[model samples]
Target: MLKKRMINLLATGFYTGLSPIAPGTVGTIAALIFALVWIQKYTISFAFILIFVCGGTLISQWAEELYGVKDASQIVIDEWAGFFIAVFGLGVDKFLLAFILFRIFDIFKPPPIRNLQKFHGGIGIMLDDILAGLMANILLRVALNFF
Candidate 1:
C-alpha cells in the first residue's frame, strides 16, 4: 500500500495528472514551475533531466502494470520529463514559448511522435512526449534563428 501510494504520488505529478480535463497540460505547467525554480544552467539541467526521464520511465512501467492500462493519463512523470527536455538550455525567457510549442507537438502527435506510441509501457509513453519535446526544441531553435 505504501509503495502504491508513493508510486501514485510521484507518477501523477503530485496528483495534478488526475484532472479529468487537460491533465497533461497541468503536469507540464507543474514542470514549468520546476524548470523555472530549479533548473539553473545547462550542466545542472542535463543531470536533472536525465534523472527525471529515467525515474519517470521506471515509475511509468510500474504504473502501467498497476493501472492495467498502457500510458494511463494518471502517469504524468512523462510530462515533466518532456517539459524539461523542451526547455533544456533555452533559459527562462523561452519557457513560455517552449511550453506552447511542446504542448502543440504533444497534443497533435505529429509523425514520429505518434509512431512512438507503438512501443509498450513506459518507453512508449515517455518516447512520444520526448519526441514532442525534441520537435519543440528544434522549432524553437529555428524560430530563434529567424526572429
Candidate 2:
C-alpha cells in the first residue's frame, strides 16, 4: 500500500534506519552525515529549517499509524530531525560532541524527554527527541564558549 511505501521511504531514513542493530543510532548517523555534507556546508535560512522540523511532526505521526506501535524503533525520522536540531547552525568541529550529548539524552530520556513520551502518537514520538536535541544543542553551545 501507499502508506507502507511512504513509511518505508520517510520513517526509515530511506531504509538506512532499517539497520538490524541500533537503528536509531544508524538514523542519527545518517543525519550526521547529512549535516556534514549539506546542512553545515550550506547556510539555509532558519525558516527553511523550521519547515523541516515542523513537517517532521506530521510525517512522524502518519508513520506511527503504519507501525502500529508507539514510537517504534523502525520510525527513525525522529532521530534524523533530532540530530538536525542538535547541529542546526553548529560547525562540523562540534559534531562529535553534539552527537555524544544528543545520543546520551536520547537514550537516557531525562526529565521532560521522558515526560514527553506520554503524549499520543507522533507528537509523543518526535517531541522527546526534539527536546533531546535542544538539550544537546544547549550543551554544545555552552561547550563552544569554553573551547
Candidate with best TM-score: 1
lDDT of 2 by residue, 28-89 (tens): 99888877778545753577567777777788788888778788788888898888788777
The 10 consecutive residues of candidate 1 with the worst lDDT sum are 36-45
Backbone clashes (count) for model 2: 0
After superposition, candidate 1 runs with Cα above 4 Å error: 40-44
Per-residue accuracy of model 1 over 1-147 as CA lDDT, tens digit each: 999999999999999999899999999998888677675443336777788888889999998998999899878899888888888888688999999999999999989788888999888889999888878988998999999
**C-alpha lDDT of residue 96 in model 2:** 81
Error of 1 at 128 (Å): 0.4
Candidate 2, superposed: residue stretches over 4 Å from native: none
Position 71, candidate 1: lDDT? 94
Query: What is the C-alpha local distance difference test score of candidate 2?
Result: 0.83
What Cα-based lDDT does every candidate model obtain?
0.87, 0.83
- Backbone clash tally for model 1? 0
Measured against the true structure, the TM-scores of the candidates, in listed sequence, are: 0.94, 0.91
